[model samples]
Target: MNSLTRWVRGPWTNPTASGLLIALAAIFSFTEGVNPFSDGHAEGAGALPAALIASDLLMVAAAVVAGTPILIKAVRALMTKMIAIDLLVSVAAIGAVVIGQYWEAAAVTFLFAIGHALEARTMKKTRSALAELVAVAPDVAVVMRDGKQVEIPAAGVEPDETVLVKNGAKVPVDGVVIGGTGALDESSITGESIPVEKGEGDEVFAGTISGGGFLQVRATGTGADTTLARIIHRVEEAQDAKAATQTFMEKFSAWYTPGIIVLALVAGLVTGDAVLALTLLVIGCPGALVVSIPVAIVAGIGRGAKDGILIKGGEYLETSARISAVALDKTGTLTEGKPYLTDVTVLDPALDRSDVLGWAARAEAGSEHPLARPIIDAAEAEGLPVHGLPERTEPVVGMGVIATLDGQRVSVGNLPLLTVEGIADDSGAATEVDRLAGLGRTPMVVTLDSRVIGVVAVADRIRSDAQEMIARLHDAGVQKVVMLTGDTQRVADAVAAQVGLDEVRAQLLPEDKLTMVAQLKADGYTVAMVGDGVNDAPALATADIGVAMGAAGTGVAIETADIALMQDDLLKLPQAVDLARRTVNVMRQNIAIALITVVLLLAGVFAGGVTMAIGMLVHEASVLLVIVNAMRLMRRNEDQHSAGPAPASDARELQTAGAGPLS
Candidate 1:
């Protein structure tokens, strides 16, 4: 069909045509002194009565223009052996015209047509978020094909191909940066507005816009294999999947529509009252009941997607509403995953602070342990000389490293390594190690030439918003926030105290973490486990909800995690929970409104004061009301309240309040 023809035949099309025809008909009826309710004659032999004839003709034309599509839909539905609301509406309008109620016929068809158009427009607004996402999907990509840059459809880009993305261009595939650097705005994928810096080996996702830099990315995924595609697919499935209440309503509606038609037939035949039976058919369309849950689900899921929270489905939303306890993996979740040098204590007065730090950095120069970077960074920051790797280095599996530097023995590790090297703790180095460990710092004793020199400590700094995030989780109805880590008891206690945790599980291996999560579930707690490492995978899977933090760049996390918080912000956890609770509340309210409207309409129809036009109006209004209620979820808060950085004094107070007997 041509565009105009298709539009004219559409359910929501050409409302202005129906509206203009109705207006003309009303004006002509008034001019001829025609009372539609009084069976006024349009065939009287006079010029004045001719105006009445024009009014009746106009009304019939308006009814036909607006009601033809509805009749066609009714016929198609009948061919399939099913009845629909359009069928009910068509029957009522046609029956009214057969009885010479031209005004009623025109009014009912016009109102139904216009209401449908408004409903379609409003529903599009409710789904605006997903539409916005689809709009940003990249259409083309620039790839280095045969060493020459060529543009191709984004879906046509082959895996492992090097794609070039310039400033302000949307990335066309999921890939890792192999050359150059750039900042990418990943808000479409992660809901974070900030542009994340990308460097060599950093991951980038499709549909993310590059910010002010050139990048050569090796495409790992394109088209349907990309993370953005998966997210969109998941959201669509979530919105389409019927909730339990919706399924029940659907089952009720399946019988309700046909039952209403049967009742209409019986009522008309038994009472010989055609108008009353037509009124019954119009009122019994089940409009609100059929639409109540879907609108809410679409709006709720769309809102979450806009905020960078991905709910698996409506069923998950229901489950999320009851979450009481949250278990968090310490590393990369509550703390910055990167460790930094915090304390450098001198044990030997002969050796200066720089000497101890330089010796430790030199010993760790060739090491690949995570803690080594901070020591080297600190040394470099202070302009200390750390030129070359050690001539010979021996690493103890769980202890530390022993290296021979410049013909002298230099060791950097825990006390166990020092003991293995026969270094005595006579200088009270053991006490200092204990003190640092008690303060949640990982202490490494430095020894030179078989003599204890000093101690260097590194600790993962707690995120500035960690305390406030826990506080907000409690406010959001979370009963307890537990800290789980492989760190020692003292370190775990220190962090737990700082973050206001209700419980702490320390020195837990990967399997131990899993056990703790299972234990929480066994204790009847709806647990949400938040983590960001491979070791956490087991615990994350074991929890009721697996939330992956800083998941924007990780395709696996985005696809697999039950709830993936795109940013590393601690506050998103509570925010996700709060959103789930709000969505569930909206769903319940919509269902209640829908059921009540159905009950009241049915009662009004049986009580004998309702007419066909009024019944259709009430039914349409109820559907609109349910839809408007669902659209409320799409409304963003004017002032988004986010957890800001806490002051230094607040941190001190938290540390004091959380301190244990050791303090």
Candidate 2:
């Protein structure tokens, strides 16, 4: 029975099904020759109309047979406030038939159901994009230990354990590379068109593709701590959030439906015309009124999906549209969040670049630091031969690396290491290193035989998409976009300017970000903060909306966020806002049209200008009108106008298409 029920209620619930029944009934009605008008005599003129009404009634019966469970569920939901408007609309539809406006009632019910099914189908399509993303998350991880490989549950992986990631495998945890190198496909993570090269010590997000070489990664974060997990969680939370428009509609329906019924009853009593009363009832059904909000919501969600934005629910969709300001956390939001080999300065003119890089990679090997990874990667790429250290290496926390190579003392770190070791200042090397560091670069100092030889400057590269996304947001409706970073002001400003951000707040701690967000709120602005680190959790919680970049299936909890823009693509933020705004506008238009139709139809009957049959016809027409109008949401892309010259060009192209060749 469950299988049968599923079959009947599945893809079969569509307008085409109802339309077929309606068509069949119309044919039967044409054969009957009954009058459509109540005033027509039974002999000739009325037979066709009467037959038509009978046909419509047959179609309605067919619909009730097919939609029995839906009707029951609608009733149950309304009783429980699970679904409000659908319940009242269903009841009103039945009341129209009980009052003898069979065709009017059937038409209203059929149209409403069809519209709902369409809305559901469209919404499902829109939501499928996120489902696709969810489907890609790895359920298992490959753990490597003591030269053996083992597959384990992704959630079971622990921090600091080496995990073997092979080609095409989804990263199961956030970790830094310890061995091997590979090209990673991060399109899903960053929304960029290119793949990124990663090597030892470079941090890779869970769920991104390790495209080529095998890698051994030491897991730093797992389970709910992964960025991807946080994104999925945030998306779900956002979906559950409600918007003001939905709330108003619920409140309106509570009184609106009952009021219509009472007005119809009053009209019936005063006019002493039962048929006129029935027409009033038919007009007051609110079929279109019930369909308005959901259709717009479905359409908005669909639009977001097309642009790679996944908004979990209508509530998040609504809130995104109302945000006034957006706060971007610098580390991963505006910058690449990975160190890249930006520059190499050789102080000892005789020291070959390749040799220096190889020494640096071997010296920094096994260190879980961002700067070390790029140096190692650069050495490997240059095919520089790296030899194992002759003696054990000691790590100076917050300083650098100290080791012995070929029985000679060697240290590669920062200026602090030289100052603390009582080594000669080497003013030339110090000045050059300071210049590089000042430009947002991390300078790795190399010391051989107790003297500084060279400095290799590495910096976290800015993400290719960051600047474009920021500009897109401004174009899409964001009033201002700002970057907040813990990095030096010079580094933050450099990245911010390149990314087209309106402002920058640099050298701020996680707490500082929270304070800044609070101040913005105090200023009466709605702020959306985007971040993807544990340090960002508090600010994410405090902002008007928190967007976590867990597109790679890492970082699963964004408890503070009202809306979670699931993918790392910052552009989705702007796309979602536009989708929300357009959806609200469509909903408003639908409600207005539905309300006006009901009011005008009731006025006609009360003024004695409309008969029961005319009232029913007009009432059904309004339902049809609203259904057609709601369908217009599906075409919103055509109606969507860009802000400037782009839309003008589109308009011209549209004009050309419309003009065609001269007839």
Candidate 1 lDDT, tens digit per residue, 1-663? 899897766656656787788788778777867764334564455555666778788888989988887788789988988777788889888898898767767877887787677667766776787788888899999999878999999999999999999999999999999999999999998888889899999999999999889999999989999888877877777777666767777778767788889998998999999887887877777777677777777787788889888777776776788899999888777776777788799999898999999999999997867788889999999999989899998877778888999999998887777778887663778899888776777788899998899998877768788888888899889998999887778878888877789999987888999999999999999999998748899998888889888777677887788887766678778888888787778878877876687678778877877777677778778878888888888876433354366753333222211111121
Report model 2's TM-score to 2 decimal places.
0.68
Give per-model TM-scores.
0.86, 0.68
What lDDT is reached at residue 598 by model 2?
75
- Candidate 2, position 231, lDDT: 56
Top TM-score hit: 1
Backbone collision tally, model 2:
25
